[model samples]
Target: MPDDCRNIYKTCRKAAGLTQEAAAERLGISVESLRAYETGQRVPPNEVVELMVILYNAQHLAFQHLRETNALYSSVVPEVRPRSVLEASAKLTNRIFLFAESHADRRLLRITEDNVIDASERAEFNAIMEDLQEIVEAALELRCARESS
Candidate 1:
């Protein structure tokens, strides 16, 4: 996860003149935990990442990488697709879902405990993952089931 999207997290924190301690305090996390996130050793949950977007004034970063369905109301949702997808049937939505999957893999998520996130956000993240999973599955189906249809 080195130099990954979480770099945006570290850059934004520094640009805002907040040390890791300060930012972690605002996010209700330990400085060590925040360091883990910045270093790409641990991925923060969506709520923590969302809080960073607000704190860092870089909402676009969330839409670009976080795949935040909540960001639809946040005005940072990208107006244009930022990527080209191999699955034409899936397009940007499937690409976004795959990015989401890549960013928060279960192996990576094992480092970030479930208790760090609240019940509501945990539920929301689960729901979002479920929807993204559906999108990804559909894309796979189309890719394997049909060719130049």
Candidate 2:
């Protein structure tokens, strides 16, 4: 489903009002690389996909917050397409794991280690809980964007 991923990436990028070059710069990649990903000439690596998910979620949240404050009405609205909640959620889960693995703070490490023992008796599932929160928040924001349009 690389084509689907490319389409989703393009939609999210446009929704955030970011040109391919701008998005690539933000993602610390080359514009040609971003274009390749968008055109399905090359599939983004897992790390790049994770970065995209973070960017998409952050942008979605910003737009949602703007709309809530009625700030969006003052400007000319850009086109925004809907995103799949399930796909977003899955991406968020991957992002959380990536974050945890990369920046293993003591508190997070303890909580994560505890969760590995008997999933039902986990001491703190904050990471997973936060992932769920991001998913819900992103979905709500996307829904708001859709409804507003």
Candidate 3:
């Protein structure tokens, strides 16, 4: 309910890999209505939210499948000088810790509905940071091993 449901809806739709027109059709809504939601001119009804959840779930599954396949292929034909998992994870953990600590001072001002959205954003950001950390560590480890040879 925070940060403009319309914008959130639109983002979720895109994240689910749905074109505006396709999402509109699936939701039994007009393209104009979908556009309005994306443009922050209108909020979707609860029914639309339910539909979006379904769409997002589907998209997440597809993404997981793709990721797994890529990982499998990479294992067989690894990249040169890639970071190791441990190094990347440690880096991301440190970054998130710093960010959370820095933002701690502003927590008092972040009250109300906007705060909820901000919190969600922070969580998503942290997740991404952790992922990047893992990637970088893997790459670093790979690079070190190559150099040692």
Candidate 4:
């Protein structure tokens, strides 16, 4: 319950088309308390979180908090947290770049005048691969930063 429920509370309340006063009334709490919970200035108790789940009729954000905080709840909800997500991402990302990088030598292939593709096409292909490499690297870095944080 110490986990911040700010975004979740706000989003759920908005999605349900309920005003802060209404949502707080449904939970039998004051609007000031609800605001505090949504502002991260206070942590709602477990019962309050459950009331949130009931009020919103969804628990996506609340469950995410539980998964990050309570290992006991996480184990009972194995599919809630997927393992090897990073490993799978790295494997696929590396394989894509490796294939493109290994094919760099292909840029040197000669083409007869009769060939449909000329030097321009070859250069463009190489350029595209280079761009793809950079994009892939950036994606991996962004993912690492997000997961770590």
Best lDDT among the predictions, by candidate number = 4
Residue 98 Cα positional deviation in candidate 3, in Å, after optimal superposition: 18
Q: How many residue-pair clashes does candidate 3 contain?
A: 13
lDDT of each: 0.60, 0.58, 0.54, 0.62
lDDT tens digits, residue span 1-149, model 4: 33543466777678678999999999999999999878777767778887887687554545655654578976654322212446546655775676668664354343323466666677766665565655554454444334433
RMSD of candidate 3 to the truth, in angstroms, is: 17.2
lDDT of 2 at 6: 44
What lDDT tens digits, residue by residue, belong to model 3 across residues 38-94?
A: 676665665665566576543222222223335674444323322344654565467
Judged by lDDT relative to the true structure, which candidate is superior, 1 or 3? 1
Worst 10 residues of 1 by lDDT: 76-85
Which residue pairs come into collision in candidate 1? none
Ranking by TM-score: 4, 1, 2, 3
Report the candidate with higher lDDT, 1 versus 2: 1
**Winner by TM-score between candidate 3 and candidate 1:** 1
**Residue range with the least summed lDDT across 10 consecutive positions in model 3:** 58-67
Ordered by lDDT, highest first, the candidates read 4, 1, 2, 3
- Identify the runs in model 4 with alpha carbons over 4 angstroms from their true place: 1-5, 71-149
Instruction: Give the higher-lDDT candidate: 1 or 4.
Output: 4
- lDDT of candidate 1 over 26-139, digit per residue (tens): 888899989987877777878888788677655444554454234454353223222223453556365566757776555336544654656545765675566555565445
Scored by lDDT, model 3 comes in at: 0.54
Q: Pick the TM-score winner.
A: 4
